[model samples]
Target: MNIIPILASAGITGFESPAAEYSQLGCNLDELLIEHPSATFIGKACGDSMQGVGIFDGDLLIVDRHVTPTHQDVIVANFNGEFVCKLLDIKRRLLLSANEKIQPVVINDFDTFSIEGVVIRSIRCHRPSPLLSNK
Candidate 1:
């Protein structure tokens, strides 16, 4: 289980107004960039297999190769040379899903399975937009 620590910084408040000063806050961008390298932006999830988990179609998924896969976490993997997004169920030995309509895929043998990476974040657009337009 790979866990990343996230620190919250306090913002500076102005004397006369409620606005905060942005210049005073400092972020360790270098450390963050080093740990989270080589991010692959997978454009849109098409299938309903992950719908019960709140991951819908046309949602942008941020896949980080740096993080290790853990139980119950959603991940993108290459199963039999095909890319698939599913929940990682390393303990139960089955990739379980909240949606009963879509059957859970059991990973009976670990040797046959290889996790590409765990999903770090998901970006969803409120309005309709093209994922990538040729024009």
Candidate 2:
């Protein structure tokens, strides 16, 4: 898909006239990957299953769908019919945990589970504290 351009409009003194200006903020996936080979754009992360791994809510995960999932690799998978992210333990047929609080989930039925992609990177934003006020 091509990059969707944003146009800026400026109002005229007498009447509001439409004006167009190209935007530089937005980018196309093809152009971005070409410029940065290590970069991969996937869907947003949900749930706290991977919080210990520094992947929190609303984080954008860069998953290389082409990459083969290995032991301990964080992967996006389709369990039954729902999508989930977890550590892959191919040998033991289990999903390991980076957090002690969360236990490893075993794959008793392989037919019900399917790996979608391997997580390559995670992106998060730092938000300013709302409670703290300036004097």
Candidate 3:
């Protein structure tokens, strides 16, 4: 995570009138969002299976391989040859899907299944894409 110095002091407000006194040094996103940068990787979500949990398709998932996944934590796992993003239910030993329509994947053997990483955050872009014109 690369961090840059905060240049501007005044913050642009939306609702009310802007305040005269503004705090210096805006917080670093890398310091706030990520813990282990070496183990962190980003993956684009491909399906709507996690939409119920606010994780939609085309979202960018920040995964940390160093973080040990606990029960009920959303994790990315490799079941056999396929990669799946779901919640871990350690007590029942099942991979729970956020979507009710989809059935939960059962973890039969620990040897066959591999935990790729835990999804720390999900980011979605709300702004429209810039139109490209032919020269």
Q: Tell me the number of clashing residue pairs for each predicted model.
A: 0, 0, 0
Worst 10 residues of 3 by lDDT: 126-135
Candidate 3 residue lDDT tens string, 1-135: 334443445666454432344454555777677889999988878788999888987787999999999999999998888888999999999999899999988899654799999999988867533431113
List residue ranges in candidate 3 displaced over 4 A: 1-14, 17-21, 128-135
How does candidate 1 score on lDDT?
A: 0.68
Pairwise lDDT winner, candidates 1 and 3: 3
Model 1: per-residue Cα lDDT at residue 127: 79
Better of 2 and 3 by lDDT: 3
**Per-residue lDDT of 59 in model 1:** 76
> Candidate 2, residue 58: CA error in Å?
1.3
lDDT of 1 by residue, 110-134 (tens): 5366777777776677877764432
Of candidates 3 and 1, the better by TM-score: 3
- Which prediction has the highest lDDT against the true structure? 3
Q: How close is candidate 2 to the true structure, as a TM-score?
A: 0.61
lDDT (Cα, tens digit) per residue for candidate 2, span 1-135: 444454444644564333333335456665564333564446677778888888987777877777878888999888878888899999999887667788888888655998888887786756633432233
**Predicted candidate 1: what Cα RMSD to the true structure?**
7.3
Model 2 Cα displacement at 63 (Å)? 1.3
